[model samples]
Target: MDTKKNIENISLLKEKMSDWRKLSDEELFLAVKEFEKMPRLEVSIYYQDLFNDPKFSKTLLDIYNKHKDNTKLVVLLVSAIGNMIQRYDLPESKEIYEFMLENSDKSKIGPYVAIFLPRLKNFESYDKKWEYFMNIKKMSPKKVAESSFETIMDLYLEKIPEHYKTEAIQYFNKKVEESNNEYGKQYYQDIINKIKS
Candidate 1:
């Protein structure tokens, strides 16, 4: 599976990323283009390290924009943002959240949005994140089970009003019906059970 090539790419990616802090905007832009060309293997290996540097937050968003068409890369990038939000004091957190809220669509990374967005501090209630999830659900119920619904249930399960729990249970059940992936269906059912109990 091109392990040697992957190793070489990883080395090159690390080498380029090492100078990110010193690079000017112009140079960083050029470097980010190089990052866009990186395969998922190498990107996955280093994304957290890169993302954890709060200094790189704006650049990370730039890299995200560069890689939007690459869903796996986007997911890794989004997940990195998730990690950054939960663990670090990111100055760009609001901007990053706004960007994701505006540009994100129903794709593999969509659920990560649901998972991470609520975790951003001083924003809206769980209701806003739920609204985002519900909007996406309106478009694709199957996407609900991918990642966000579980996070939604976990985060808002207790915070939400009783009536919303009943509504969420209905959505979870719909997700179970719509998901063809056995694992995803099971996940939805589990959340339904959690809500019901």
Candidate 2:
């Protein structure tokens, strides 16, 4: 594949994202998928450029403001922003997190929010992180359980605060016991042992 051309094409696609109303649904969907798969760092740079472009960001925000029914577009935006925050280690992640917190229920964007929370260095103290996890647990039990395991493992390895570390381990153990999958249980047990040491 011609990576340079792909990058340019991706940039071109993003340039038109604000004019999504002008494109057919199929075209918009394909374009969003293409942009989504671009190298994460590249996508972050793309968004940084877009954010810097007053015309583009204003137009994009206007479209989002007007098209409240366009759930797909909302998802794409949330996913893109979340990826940008995670991949770029952007300083603006807190702003994106705040945006997601405010708009999450309106767009059913909780999963993307969940994914973003773990990336924030100081996210451990945020009540929104727990709420995000609870929202996921209510809406997608399996995914919440799985992510809980992953998050706890990460916290243990990262050596988070003692209280939070205890909470993570307890949450993981609870979910592992409740989970039906034998492999999930074994994986949780292994991680629990790893954490203890």
Candidate 3:
């Protein structure tokens, strides 16, 4: 049951998605257009449900490709992809992770990619997965180290490929030593110790 909603009107879209779960496919497309215009926090609140639907995912991905320079929308899109990756764990999401790597910034959506990419597994090698994490190193040192450390523990706990765990630890440790951000270093040390024990 689609409504005669104008997709270009952001406020109307948000109002319509006050109960987002009940939206029709056509209405959802409009909601996605609205979400593309939303702040990250609002998008995060709303898109969690949308990411569960494969159709919304593909649509959001298409929107993602369309908005390369639109950092806000891209972050929301990558977050949607990451949330879907975390929630569903289906299909090859290496491309999504790669997109995050190439397009997302550390101060922005990079942390999401840093943390989430380790969770995805494909039929083939995780060369791209590791490459994404390694690419995070080029971002602000303290933040990358701090954020990635958590994902390292997640990898260790998830038992995602023995070699992958090894690589995550090595990268995490290197960043910890290099970063002057003491809080980040302490946080990393705290989590790493917990994972070790």
Candidate 4:
């Protein structure tokens, strides 16, 4: 679906899912299990709205603990937990980070953890996190997978602070030069232009 349609769908879903906030812990896990069977984008839209409930963080971690062996769901859960950490002071953030750290060696998950794990400032100082994030050439992908180039670009575009924009653009330029993937090179150029403009 297009962006506008996705927003409308999420809004509609929010109306139905508001009751999800009030669900008991067990009930919430049941709800998550049902969500897991749905399309990824739809599941993402639903959980993105669901994460607004502070109570949901524990359930998110619980769900992670149960399903960490499922790499596809783990990616979604890691991203959700990362979003929750960014938006709230959840106690589960550290454990969630550790979980992602344990799974970071997987090809599909590594680039995502590389992108999202650095967002937690408690684990590392801001400068140190940026140093690590900027140095990961994998974050600027020559090949896209479940953790896609678009997703990585979007996260960097959304999360990059103003002070880091210049450094990010320079980094993108370097990736654009070194990458053999034509689409990846163009994507880097496009994002750099977006940052410039």
Candidate 5:
């Protein structure tokens, strides 16, 4: 899919969202599902609207509560919220971030946590982020490489303690060395260099 086109569509949808009351529940649900399938930036716009609309907000929260036990629904909800937290400067962003951290299942929380790390200022207080990184070390190196890239970028941007920086670099370097993909290796190397410089 063309991510740029998806972004444009999201912009259009945002404009139309002021008139969302015109859309039936089925239409609104389908629109949200379609937006979720779009590029990450596009998904964020829909999520932002959901949070902004009183009706949609109630609907979404109902859906979340109803399907909180369904892993697929949980993944979709958490991922959508994560995309919003990453893409926009919304007023409820921090509350949403804290909610995800507190409510999401530990096994399925890594990706959402990785997405939030770069935007946050301090890493030391978010011990779960570090714990997630350490736990993922047991996975295959490819999984390790792909999974940790965002987390490493977050660490690079955040005010991580000096002691953690060394461990973070070593962890990223190990992933880079194990990564078979040249692009992935280069991305980690660039992050390492950026952090070191």
Candidate 6:
């Protein structure tokens, strides 16, 4: 880790992030990017906490618009959108989620978007997101797992009709059998348990 970045991270995290609204959008983006040094799970919470002020929503949207084609940056943008949705329940997330599906692949930020898309009211049913997940299936196992498996499996287990739920389990089981990766098998099994119980 770069010591400069580490120091910057410590300084930023030390402050009350809600006060970060005073910072310009570029500064805010820098702060958000500083989170790259963190464990993946923590980044979203930091985003949620810091960017809660609705003023920053447009900042995030603008950043995402400008860098959507940059694969490295897009992950952070997707996490920011997910963070906002998780923390504030913002109503306008359909477009951000749509952008994720359009620009991201199945094995990358695609799974994260697949998971969150249903949270918006328009996706009360699972079909649209499900179709998108399948489209990304052409990616490698690691990629598909990264892109769709985690999110879509959870979606079926929680929200879909009973028949569809069983179907998802079966579908995942098939994938597990086809997969050479033991980790993927265990993952599918874990998902099966989550859905069943």
**Candidate that would win on TM-score:** 2
Q: Which has the better TM-score: candidate 4, or candidate 6?
A: 6
Cα lDDT for residue 24, candidate 5: 72
TM-score of 1: 0.56
What's the C-alpha lDDT at position 28 in model 2?
71
Off by over 4 Å in 2: 24-30, 39-63, 89-95, 103-108, 121-128, 156-171, 174-186, 194-197
Q: Which portions of model 3 miss their true places by more than 4 Å?
A: 1-50, 88-98, 104-107, 128-138, 141-145, 157-197
How high is the lDDT of residue 21 in model 1?
64
Please provide, for model 2 over 1-197, each residue's C-alpha lDDT reduced to its tens digit, 9 standing for 90 to 100.
46567657767877777678898867776766666565354444444553344454344445555554666675666665566546644444344555566554443445545555556665667665544543454443347445743763565475544555566567668868887999989877777666666
Model 3 lDDT tens row, 1-197: 11122223434554565555576645655566455443323234344444445554555566556556665566556665665556544244556656755753546566656655555564135555544544565564456545664555555555445555565567557757976999978866665555455
Per-candidate count of clashing residue pairs (backbone under 3 Å): 0, 0, 0, 0, 0, 3
Worst 10 residues of 4 by lDDT: 140-149
RMSD of each: 6.6, 4.8, 8.6, 8.6, 6.4, 6.7
**Each prediction's TM-score versus the true structure:** 0.56, 0.63, 0.50, 0.46, 0.57, 0.56
Better of 5 and 6 by TM-score: 5
Q: Which candidate has the highest lDDT of all?
A: 1
Residue 81 displacement (Å), model 4: 1.6
Give a tens-digit lDDT track for model 6, residues 86-184. 554544555665665565454555655654554556655535555555444445445644445556556656655565566667766776797788998
Q: Write the per-residue lDDT of candidate 1 for residues 56-172, one digit (tens) a residue.
A: 666567666655676665665665556555544345466686766754554555665666666666446434555565555443335554455566566766665666777788877
| Candidate scoring better on lDDT of 2 and 6 | 2
Candidate 1 lDDT at 51 equals: 35
Model 5 stretches with alpha carbons more than 4 Å out: 1-35, 38-55, 85-90, 93-95, 117-155, 181-183
Q: Residue 10 CA error for candidate 2 (Å)?
A: 1.1
lDDT for 152 in candidate 3 is: 55
lDDT of each: 0.60, 0.58, 0.54, 0.58, 0.54, 0.57
| Candidate 6 residue runs with Cα over 4 Å from true position | 1-31, 35-49, 88-94, 104-107, 125-127, 140-147, 158-171, 174-197
Badly placed stretches (over 4 Å) of model 4 are 1-50, 87-92, 125-135, 138-174, 178-197
Q: Candidate 3: lDDT of 77?
A: 65
